[model samples]
Each structure stands twice: as structure tokens, then as C-alpha cells.
Target: SDIFGEIFGGGRGGRSTVFRGADLRYNLEISLEQAAHGFDTKLRIPAMATCESCKGSGARPGTAPTTCPSCRGAGQVRVSQGPFSIAQTCPRCHGSGSIIPHPCAQCAGSGRIKLQKTLSVKIPSGVDEGDRVRLSGEGEPGVNGGPPGDLYVQVHIKPHPVFTRDHDDLHCEMPVSITSAALGGEIAIPTLDGSAKIRVPAETQSGKTFRLKGKGIKGVRSQAPGDLFCHVVVETPVNLTERQRQILREFDAISQQDSARHNPRAKGWFDKVKEFFES
Candidate 1:
């Protein structure tokens, strides 16, 4: 049935005379901060618009199109062979059912012209990458009398330098001095809003994660703000002076006197290694 319809130049009900326009797609890039907070921007698009000189009729000014003589305005022609009747588009009118005796000079009988259009776009908050924003009736102009198609704007978020985002949560690695990690202290950390302080417990180990509540992004559908996780990384001292080296050596000697109390993790690993070797 579909093949017959194609050969006859007719669809399920009949041949459609109206022409529908094609949809347009555009990719828009925005910053992560802008994605967190909504913003408005303008975009330029290259598309097709109906010709003004001919009023989309493809005919010259003050002249009207005439019905195609081949199909008698039916836009299709039929051929009979034996017991079969094959119908196809009228070659003279090319399925338009009319012929422009004097074509429009502007669009050269195409009924449309290329144009550059400027449009304003509004991005909603918490819009993630690959999200699409639709603008109704903003695509290429329709042919004949059909309505215009829609425009789709795809979203792309730029990478952030200081932090990595996961949905609404945020993660960052904070470097701390070895002494600070051992003795415990307060350190200033960066947040989306501003700088905040986090307290490190005494004997805090490297790679410990501290959660800062309500410091992350507040998504569009979220009831409460997400959390910011700071992963502590103990930094080893480098480029020590003569006096600092001597003091560290003395401190190391004092620490070795009670390895179990000062470095319980190292002592436990050594005990495990000894047991593995004996076994």
C-alpha cells in the first residue's frame, strides 16, 4: 500500500498540498556558573524566509499562477497499463498543481530566500549538558501555507577549574601541611558562594573527606542545597633548611621511640608484613 501510494504520489488519505517547514537545531555553550544560575543570551541563525516580493507565491508581481494543464490542477498524472493504473506527480507542475508563467525575480521561483536572523534565548537554572530548549515557530519559514517548525537549542556546560560537579554535589581536593594534619587545625576552603572554614580533627589522616553542608549548588528541583566534600591531602615538607632538617631528624627520633603511639598505621602494616613472611 505504501509503495502504491508512493507511485501514485498520494498518501494515506490523499496528496497533501500544504508544505511544512523543516526544524532547526543549534548548539549553545554556557559556563557552569551560568548553568547554576539562569541567564539570557542572543543567538544568530542562518535560515530561510518567505520571499516578500512574490508573497511566497513564486509568481511575478500583479500576476497569478495558472493551473497545471498536465494534471488539470490535481498535481498528479495516471498511466494505464493492462489491468494496472500507475499514478505519479505531474511533471509540468512538479506536484505543486500550478505553474508560474512569470517567475519572481527575488527568489527565482523558489518562494523563499536565505536570511540571517537574531533570536533571544533564556536558559533556565540547573540545566545540564545535552539539555534542549525549544522555541516554537522559530525555524525555517513554511512553504505554501503551512506553519513554521520549531527550533531546538542544545546546552553544553564548560569545564570548571577549581571544583568538579556531580549533579548538585561538589568535590574538591584540599592540600594541608603534614603538621596541620597531625596537630589538627582550621583551614579555609573555597565554596560556590564564598570561602568557608573546616576544622580538622587531631590525628586526621590523609585522604579524609569533610562534608560542608549546604555549600554546594542548589539545583532547580532540589528541596535543599547539596553538600561540598573536601578531600584532605597531606603535603610533605620540601626544600628544608639546615635547621629545619635537624629539627625534623630530632622529631623523627622522638617519634620512633613509640612507633605504636605516634604512627599506629605504619606499625600495624609492619606487623602484618612480619606475619605474612612467617606464614
Candidate 2:
């Protein structure tokens, strides 16, 4: 049996036709702050659109298409092979069940042409890296009377410099001068918005974390802003002059006279070690 033939073995033709189209994809990159806050961008895409000259009819100017003679108006043809009788697509009409003797010059017989379209896309807040922003009905145009496909926009966020972000909290290292750590003073700390001063207590130790409330990123779903954690790193004295070195040595000598008074923990630990040896 042939692919196309006269329906009911009479005038040429068939039943209904099936048409499908193609889909499109795009990649978009945004900043971390933009992803956290949300923004809109424009996208230019190349796709196929229905031919204007033929208005998607695919017929020549001033000429109309004729119903397929092989499949009548149905689009499918029935054939008998050996002991089997089955339905096949009509070749003459290519399942469209119509024929244009004088096809449109612009699109030939396809009914669509290449074009470029610019579209605006909106980005939602709190969308992290590798997130996808979908735009429905924004892909390539459909084929021969079929529905159009979809467009997908994949998102990527750039890295920040000063602060490191976790889920919502921001982490940063803050250096404190030796005097600030020992005698206690105000030290400036960095935040997303601006610099802030934190009071350092006397004898403050290194690796202590100070939290600033409402200073970190605020997600779209969060009720309150996340916290900013500042880890203190005590800075040692450098470029000491001869007089400064002598003063430091005298201070150390005074503290060493009574270890039990200046360094009670060290004296207690040594006593415990001696007792352990005797036992």
C-alpha cells in the first residue's frame, strides 16, 4: 500500500492531521544582590514566526489552497497490504489534507520565517545560583497549526567580595588591635550597609564572635533580617622601637614576679602536674 491514496478508493484524500513545533532555551546571569533582591532583564531570542506575506496560509498571492484530493479533507489514507488493512498519512497533502499549487514565495510552503524577538523577563527575589526562571509560551513558534513551545531561563549569581554568605547569615573577619583587645576600646566593623563601631571589653580574647542583629541578608520569605557574625582576630604589635621594646620587657618582668597573681591558671596547672608526679 502507498502512503497517500484516494479515501474509500474514490476521489483522493484522508482524516485529521498532526502538527508539532520546536522549543527554545536561554541562559541568564545576575548578581548576588540582584538575586537576593529581585530584578528584571531583557532577553533577545531568535525564533520562527508565521509568514506575514501568506498570513500562515502558505498560498501564493491572490491564490487559495485546495482540499487534498487523495485524503479528501481528513489528511490520512487507508491502504490494503496482503492480509492487513491500515491507515497511513497522505503523501500529497503531508497530513495537512490541503494542497497549495502556488506556494507562498517568502516561506515557500512552510508558512513560517526566521525572526528575532526581544522580551522582558522578571526575576523573583531569593533565587539562588543554578535557579531557573521559566517563561511560558515564549519559545519558538509552533509548526503547521500546532501550539507554540516554551522558553526556559537559567539563572546564575555572582560571588561577593568582603562577606561570605551562608543560608542567610553573613560571616566576616574583624581585626582588633592589641591595645583594643587588652585595654578595651571601640573598633570599627564592616557591614553590608556601612561601618559600625563595636565596644571591645578589657581582656577580650581572640576568636570571639560578635553578632550584629539585622545586618545580614533578608530573604523574601524571612520575617526578620539575618545576623552578621564578626570573628575577632587580635593583631600583634609590629615595627616596635627600642623604647617600646624596653617598656614591653619591663611590663613582662613585673607580671612574671607573681605568676599565681597574674597567671593563676598557669600556676594551678603546674601545681596539679607536680601533685600527679608525686602520686
Candidate 3:
């Protein structure tokens, strides 16, 4: 009959034990555009793998681990500390309850080796800064036929130069010439894909924003693309020739006389300031 005894090494009716390994973590940096879209990346990392020479058993190739005689295969030793009797790990077997007579030379009985490993990971779309991606069973190898640990890859997205991104939308400055802004003309605007034409309405003021539908980043939660906000910045003419400067001076003079027609906002602000000064 298979009847169990005290089970503390009594009649040898206990279950066999195994060893497990430790987990690992890594960090990765990607571009902001890459985060908007999913990407495949590879990383090189240093990890501990099981020794092949002894098949991770730590004993020599042909020899198996034998029960430790020092602790009688119990993996612990009784220590009487003053008024207490404490059971601590056996020094001979390191609490494994077994000893390798002929240890493997490669890992020196540590059962693992330090080596560089390359792992490929797939980054999902809409992953933001400080996001973590878990890779199962890709950490340190298991010990003594145990299950391996997990690998955590922390992600970071680099800042973009031209665009500022929120959750799904993008904001950027679009420079339009003074002539084009006032007279109403088509100007080239920069986008993620390429340059596109956006019409500047007549009398368009600086700091005004225009939205381009379906032109921003696409989020995983919402397939509906975000809008791209183009903030208007009226750029003054530069590197003007003598004739161009004269023409601009004449234009400025003509536009300055009639404030209501040309510069209504500025004229209204100045009129308020004059009224305050008079009061």
C-alpha cells in the first residue's frame, strides 16, 4: 500500500523538487513616429543560460547529483542559537539536498553561464512613453527543469522636431507669407506623409488654427484618425531687394492710414489705449 508517513524524510514519500530561475528587464527607445505605428525591433542583452555540458544538472556529463551526506538529503541543518533551535540551509549542498561530486567545468556548478542573447520583440501601436511590453519565457533559463521567468521591455519614444503629439492629435506651426495670408493663396503645408496644399483665406490673421481631418496619428483604440492642427504664423518678407523694399514701404503707408479697413483689431486696441490715457 502507498501510505504516507510523517513525510519529513520519513519513509521517503515526498514529491521531487525542482529549481526556477530569475526574471530580467530591459529598456528600449524608439522614434515618435514609430510609436504611432507598430514596429519590429531586436535587442542585444546579457543573460544567464543553463550550462549545456551538464544539461543544467551541475554534475559532470555522465554523473547525476547524489544525496548530500552532510545533512542526510534534508537540505537543512539544525543550529542551536542560545534558547532556539533553527533549521538553516545546509552548507555542503546549498539547501538543494544533493551534491555534485564532479561538477561541470563550464559553469563551475552554478548551472548557468553568462552569454549575450538577441531577442526580437514586436511593439504594438499606440504604445506611449514608459509603457511596458512583457515577453513570456524570454528571461533567464529555468533551473533543474523548472519554468523560465519573464522579460519586461520598457519603451520610450523620442521627441519629434516639427510635430507635438497628444493622445492622437498633432499640432504644428505653419508659416505663411504676409502677401499670401492677406491676399488668399494656396500654401504648401508639411504633413507626416508629404507636403499638401492648404488654402489661406483672405484676411487670415496670425495665430489662427486650421484643422486637417484624418491627418493626425491613428490610435489603436480608435481607428478614426485624429486631426492635424495648423497654427498660422504670418512670416514677414526677408532678403528684399531695393524695389521690393520701396514697394513694401508704400504698401505699409497706404494700409496704415485707413485702420478700420486694413487693421481693424490694431486700430480698436489703440483707440482703447487713447481713451484710457485721456481719462
Candidate 4:
């Protein structure tokens, strides 16, 4: 019986439709410390708000909407097709069964206005990059007072000067002196909590990894915290004095006598190159 309305009318059965507002996304950048411990901040966003001038009625002050004259409040009109009659939405009121003779000048009959609103947002701890925090009913105001949408806050951790994140683990390059790598020493590494120390064993090679347990972030759903990995990079001595240069030269000669034992990786690489060339 109402198939004609579904086929020809703009809405269902010529009745006015209510619509939920649009959802919105916001990218939020936070420091690693802030992300690790959580923080509260205020955000000012641009959105549509209900018009105060018309009280969402879209009618001018001291006036009200009047019933549609074309449909006589039935919200529908009829057209004759041979011997059959088909119902369609009223052209005058557009199926609202009413008309505003004086539209509010401020809103231009939109019943809403563009404005900025400030909202307090709480960031939960352990929110990794790409995570979304949803705030219900905080998006654009609904159409016809139906329902509002949601606001999604996307998490993006700002780049840290000393650390890089990987899921729950954190990684950092620790520069050690050539003397420290050769003779072994204790080095202090940075963690989210603070600084911690790791012992470098004797003859420690460059690119050695030292892991600190429970020094990384704990995820939102994780039962235990992650680890922090410290990659060792042996740094060469620069601006050497004449005596320093002479001492290094003597040490190099001593190491050269037993290069295979002192520089095993370089010896192995040279051996591989020699075999490849000979073959």
C-alpha cells in the first residue's frame, strides 16, 4: 500500500526522517611520558551547535511554525494516475506537515550554528599509537533532535629524543667508548621510569644488546610490562694526542700479530672474501 512512497518519495512513507549527526576524528599527539602515565587536557574543536536564536525550531523569535496548507497537516499529497491515486510528500512542507514563514536570521533556518566548543579529555595509560578513544554524543549535533554521533580521539606518540617504541618494548642506542668495550664497564641507560645500569662484559663487541626487564611500557590489556633493549655502539676516540696515537699504534701492532683472535669478525669476513675470489 505504501510502496509508492518508498519508490517515489524522498523519505519512507512521506514521513520526515530523523538523522544522527556525523562522527568526527581527531589526531592527538602526546609525549611518551604523558602516554605512559596518562594525562588530562582540554581540546577546543569546531562543530555545529543548536541555535540559541531559534531554540532549534528554525522559526523567528515571537513566531512559530504553521501547518502546511498544501497537505493540510497530512504531510502527503496525491497525484492521479489514470484510475489509481499515488501518495507523495507535500511539495510545500517537504513532508514535515509544517512551514516556517519567518526563518531565524542567525541560523538561516538550519536550526544549528557553527561554533567552537571546549571539552576535557582524559587519556588512559598504555594507549599505543593508532589507538582510538571514543567519546559518546560528543560529535556533531543530531538532525531533527534525533541523536548525536561520537568523537574518536586517535593516539599518536610524539617522537622521543632518546627512545623508539615497538609495540610494548622500547629501544635505544647506547654509545660506549672503545676502552669500555675492550675492558668492560658499567653504563647507565635510560628507561621510562628513570636511569638504570647495565654491566658490559669484557671484550664486548659493538651492536651488543642488553635487555632490562620490566623497564618498558605495559599495554592496556597486558598482564606484565615489556622490556627495554639497549644496543651498544662502540665509539672511536677522536682528537688523539701524539702520545695517545703512539700508544694506539703499538696496541694495533700487538693486535695485528694475533688479528684472528682479537678481531674475529673481521678475520671471518676477510676469509669469506678470499674464498669467494679464489673459487
* CA-only RMSD, every prediction: 3.3, 6.2, 4.4, 2.7
Candidate 3 lDDT over 1-279, as tens digits, reads 113223222233111466466778898989877887789989899988888887788877888888888777877766666755566667887777788898888888777888999999999887777888999998888755778898999988888888998878989998888988889899888887687789899989899899999888787677787889999999988899999999988988998888688989988999999999999
Q: How many backbone clashes does candidate 3 have?
A: 0
Per-residue lDDT of model 2, residues 115-228, tens digit only: 889989998876666767778877766655667778888887677776777767889888888778889999888776779988989888789999999888777567777899
How do all models score by TM-score? 0.86, 0.65, 0.83, 0.88
Candidate that would win on lDDT:
4
Better of 3 and 4 by TM-score: 4
What are the clash counts of all predictions, listed in order? 0, 13, 0, 0
Model 3 misplacement above 4 A? 1-20, 275-279
Candidates in descending TM-score order: 4, 1, 3, 2
In candidate 4, which residue ranges exceed 4 Å CA deviation? 1-16, 70-97
Better of 2 and 3 by TM-score: 3
lDDT of 1 by residue, 1-279 (tens): 457657665532122467678899999988878887789999999989999999988888899888887877777777776766677777988887788899999989888999999999999887777889999999887767889999999999888887888888889999999889989999999886779999988888888999998887777778877889999899999999999999999999999999999999999999999999999
Model 1 misplacement above 4 A: 1-16
* Candidates' C-alpha lDDT: 0.85, 0.78, 0.81, 0.86
Worst lDDT run of 10 residues, candidate 3, spans 1-10
Which should have the higher TM-score, number 2 or number 4? 4
lDDT of 4 by residue, 1-279 (tens): 466656655243322467899999989999998887888999899988889999988899899888788887768888888866677778898887778999999998878999999988999888899998898999988877679999999999999999998878889999999999999999888788988999999898888999998898888877888889999999999999999999999999999999999999999999999999999
